[model samples]
Target: MSIEREDLMICPARVTLDAAQMAFFDGLPTKAPSVQAELGCELEQGHEGSHAALGQQVDTTMWWIQWTLSASEINPYTWCPATHLPDTERRDDKDCALFNGHPGSHSSAKRSWQASEAA
Candidate 1:
């Protein structure tokens, strides 16, 4: 089945960077803006608390970045090829409202846990 891009609601893709990469990204003050302009979407920096769960202490100094996607730019099914078919189909039915008020859903909990353990 083919899906129309404009009919899909897209969410931001969050990425966690290692210390070195974070440093590079931060070193260039205009990096975020440049990326945002090129992608035609917001590229935001997430806070530490958003990186880990409440009351959790993390050791590694990782930085979080989010790339906001527009409905015309992403098709959940195509973007997340490994995601279950049901989930891909659900995005359209739900109008991508699934992430409302759910910051935890976007948090890099797994990455934080792994980084902390590695430290």
Candidate 2:
């Protein structure tokens, strides 16, 4: 089964899943009675599947994407920039992005996060 590349999480890191691995990911269900479809993360530096649960849960601590990346060729780690004020000089209190109270960091002090490594 070939999954749409656009449907993947919008992360810069390499999605190194091979055909077989992709087949496995494609075959897995995104939702269950308790689990919901994990939407792709839009944050510039957020980790893949950070915005949603992309894969089924393998256990209490990890999900299927995590399992797949363990063997795939990706960066050593994924550290996304917390949401920051687009203009830190002014009194702008709103986040640069529309999302608020999201996961990861949202500290007003942070002006930006790590520079993107790849497209």
Candidate 3:
């Protein structure tokens, strides 16, 4: 009962990262890390910048499809924007380190590192 994902639809959202963030990302390793990536994510693509630059986003639960989008393609509106939730009473004041519109659960919802928690 497994579906073939080779033909699944993908999200096409693309945005520009702000100058500071883009500059920071450009400094990270693109294919291999000559320096420590400093990221603390647990996903296979979460290790280093070089690895991430070459990896594509792969979560199916998000309202936006990102299986075909590259990690390099995502540029959040801002860090810890907290604009995704519709709830008025969650009362979670902890901010996520990942950018807005990131895939998977927010960092505030979990203690460990996640796919989009990279800075």
For every candidate structure, what is the RMSD over all alpha carbons to the true structure, in angstroms? 14.4, 13.6, 12.7
- TM-score computed on alpha carbons, candidate 3: 0.26
Against the true structure, what is each candidate's TM-score? Answer: 0.19, 0.24, 0.26
Residue 38 displacement (Å), model 3: 6.5
Clashes of each: 0, 1, 4
- Over 1-45, each residue of candidate 2 has an lDDT whose tens digit, in order, gives 875443343344433345664565455453322322332333334
Candidates 1 and 2, the one with greater lDDT: 2
Cα lDDT tens digits for candidate 3, 35-71: 2223223213232231111111122111111122354
Candidate order, TM-score descending: 3, 2, 1
lDDT of 3 at 51: 17
**Cα deviation of 87, candidate 3, in Å:** 15
Runs in model 1 deviating more than 4 A are: 1-59, 70-102, 106-119
* Candidate 3 segments whose C-alpha is farther than 4 A from its true place: 1-35, 38-77, 83-93, 109-119
